[model samples]
Target: MLLSFRGAQHLRSWPYFYYRQKSHFDSAILLSNPRNLSQFSRAQPISARAMSTGRGALIVFEGGDRCGKTTQTQLLVQSLQSMGLKAELWRFPDRTTPTGKMIDSYLSSRSEVDDAAIHLLFSANRWEKRAAMLRALREGTTLVVDRYSYSGVAFTASKGIPSLSISWCKAPEEGLPAPDLLLYLELGAEDAAARGGFGSERYETLDMQQAVRRQFESLRDGSWTVVDAARPRDAVHEEVKAHAVEAVRRCAEGLEPLRALWSREPLA
Candidate 1:
């Protein structure tokens, strides 16, 4: 099932887009990377309705660039599918949507946007699809989102622009779906640079990534699980799978209704 949506304007005004377009990825698309996903060869019957309320877990993977989040997200999704679990992968700056197109232009340096404006655009990219996302979750499909509100706050607040305070950056994202488990694929900025170096995008530089890392660190609390991203892919997969399974169980066992980011009670 193609997860991408169209007509951002229509998606905003109509809630039907959420219920009408519910779909999942085909096995071929889910298991294309045998090298990484081939490790899981057995299928266990883990129901899509893992949560007590029959909703799927919202698992988010966050980290600096070059931390292998994309690869890991794919592998984890494959693993879940291999076990007969209903799982899907979603990424931010979905790039396919209209608002996402604007974000893409700014990230690739094709166009310039004010910092605050671009930040909200990123949030809007997610907002336009909230209903669709909620449908999947409520229908018992675990969502492994590539990036979430953390990235919004981290990258934008990293700029240190006085007007674009962390609070301001986080405000727009308050009502988005909160993750059941927030995993930070922890990697140092220097190590990330050594992996393959930065990309040509706006915040892909070492300096910017370093600053983003600091912002991510500040948001760390009990809800976050800091994984050692430097570990071998298989090793990291092992760790991610364990945490994901537990998080799924938690969500299935009856989680509270989704709330705003950072609005839950403070961490001890």
Candidate 2:
């Protein structure tokens, strides 16, 4: 069954029956099979306080360098789209933006930036997309994001800069949209070194990667789903797909108002 929002005039094409709730937003819960109607009937209508009638799940992929986060994000987005769900792929350091261009220059070693400044630039890169990201989710476009604030914190804090504590690293990211599912692609340091094109970028060295991994471990919480990326690609994709599908289902039913990341507590 699919959950979507549609105007009354546009609901005639499908054989499915939907329970319509009229609000400031026209929200419709569509059940493909009539039998499911009873189940949906017993379910509570989505709260009016939600961002919209329905919002897409934010699924984030995070891990050390060369841990297959990029590959997994693409595959997961493809899988969701193939299932007829709305999904889009997003990534951090969106290098096309002006702020991102500076970050790109620093990461590529063409220019040097202060460690503290570079860290904030990374966070700013995401801050620039905050509005659009929220809009996509509210419009039912599930986002499969590669890297995020977690990467900013993990990579920057791994630098061991005296001023950049874990809590300080997390501060700028406080108000960003939190992911419904955070998938951490776990790979050993040795395995990550063996991956092709290792050390091609600023943070790809073994020592740096190891440090980043330690930082990620410290940041992990109960909300994270750790996947063993050493397995074959398809095997990892199956585990990711299962979690993503469940997250989407939960969001479609009703998502709490978008929450701020690390708003209430400092990272340990």
Candidate 3:
């Protein structure tokens, strides 16, 4: 299903986005390389449902630019599908939209703009996708987001703006749909540099990225797990799968509703 809601105003408040109670399901999918997601094969029954709503859980894989988040997210999607769960993965800055096009220009240095202006544009990009994201959540499909509001705040604040704390930066995204589980891949900036630095995009610098890592650690709530990304992909996927399974179970148990994760509160 597709939802068409647009405009700059935020639709929900922080409390609504961050706190709420919901059940979690216990299931998992494992993955290999990006294209070779067939490394593992297994189909579990949709045999598990919390309250018979049969809704698929929402999970997000978030981290710095070169943290292998894409690979991990794909693996998770494959694993969920293998288990008979309907899952979908989405990447932010969806360059497909008009707002996203603007963001893309800024990221690629094709356009010159203030740091703060671009920051809000990123937030707007997420906002534009708000309706569709919520629809996915309600449609019994496992939603795996490669990046979400978390990246918006962390990356922007890392830009060294004064008076821009995590809370301040994230206020705009408050009230946005909350994820049942947020996997924060942990890796040193140096390792990320070794893997690949900024890919000709704004906010991909080593120093800025290091700062964003710090910001992410601070904004993290209870539903997040920080896994080591300094090892092999298989090892990282193993760790992600274990925690992901537990998180799904927690969501099934009616874990606290995320009061809300995103907001459009005016920057204070």
Q: Which number leads on lDDT?
A: 2
Error of 2 at 113 (Å): 0.2
lDDT preference between candidates 1 and 2, better one: 2
lDDT of 3 by residue, 1-268 (tens): 1111232123121111111123433333333333322222221223354423444566888888888998999987787666555678888988989988888887888988777777778888888988777676555666788998888888878877787766777778776777777889988887887785445566777887889898888788766877888888887877676555545545444453433664323221
Report the error of model 1 at residue 212, Å: 0.5
Q: After superposition, how far is residue 26 of candidate 3 from its true place, in Å?
A: 12
Error (Å) of candidate 3 at residue 267 is 23
**CA lDDT, every prediction?**
0.76, 0.79, 0.67
lDDT of 3 at 145: 85
| 147-206: candidate 2 lDDT, tens digit per residue | 999999999999998899999999999889888889999999889999999988888899
- Steric clash count of candidate 2: 0
Model 1: clashing residue pairs? Answer: 50-252, 51-252, 52-252
Give the per-residue lDDT digits (tens) of candidate 1, residues 1-268: 1223354433343322111113442222122223333232222223333432466888999999999999999999998777656899999979999999889989889999988899999999999889898889888889999998889999999999999998898899876777888889999899988876477678888899999999998988888998999988977887787678667756665644555567764211
Order the numbered candidates by TM-score, best leading: 2, 1, 3
Q: Pick the candidate with the highest TM-score.
A: 2
Indicate the TM-score of model 1.
Answer: 0.79
